[model samples]
Target: MPPKPKKKCCSDKPACKRCPLQMMKKGTLPPGYTVKKRKLVKVKKSDKKSKVAA
Candidate 1:
């Protein structure tokens, strides 16, 4: 079974097993969730916007 996710992050340099940051490195982070600056953040639709020359 996959390891359970942690409710909060300890922000350790070497993230723990249940750390979201570690989970992200292992590509196990759930959809809509991403790690930024070592913190787990919910993805926003606008954040996906890319600058495209029309």
Candidate 2:
């Protein structure tokens, strides 16, 4: 039998959230740095009928 494959990390940066290294450290950030909060922006949808009429 073959061994199970390891899961891949999804974070863009090294040791970022969702990374195995981050999980191993128990969610603590490196010294002299803080986590930045991301804000969500809502976009308004344009009407297709109005675009076709133009």
Candidate 3:
């Protein structure tokens, strides 16, 4: 049997660049395929004080 494709989980991952869902959201995906979606969100700052506790 042929080797299976290496799975990718991020848009920046070369394997996921042309994924169906990414294409669908951009209206470039073709009919009948589905994909898992993930949001690459920004990190939020903490509300704690700058000083550290002993």
Ranked candidates (lDDT, high to low): 1, 3, 2
Q: Please give, for residues 1-54, the per-residue lDDT of candidate 1 as tens digits.
A: 778667568877777888987898799888888877766788877756788999
Candidate 3 residues 7-51, lDDT tens each? Answer: 233546554545544554666543333344443223456788799
Clash pairs for candidate 3: none
Query: What value of lDDT does candidate 1 attain over all alpha carbons?
Result: 0.78
| Candidate 1 TM-score, true structure as reference | 0.57
Between candidates 1 and 2, which one is better according to lDDT? 1
Please write out the lDDT profile of model 2 over residues 1-54, one tens digit for every residue: 322212444556554454444443464433333232231123345566554654
TM-score of each: 0.57, 0.24, 0.31
Question: What is the alpha-carbon lDDT of model 3 when measured against the actual structure?
Answer: 0.45
What candidate 1 gets wrong by more than 4 Å, as runs, is 1-4, 11-15, 47-54
Residue 7 lDDT in model 3?
Answer: 29
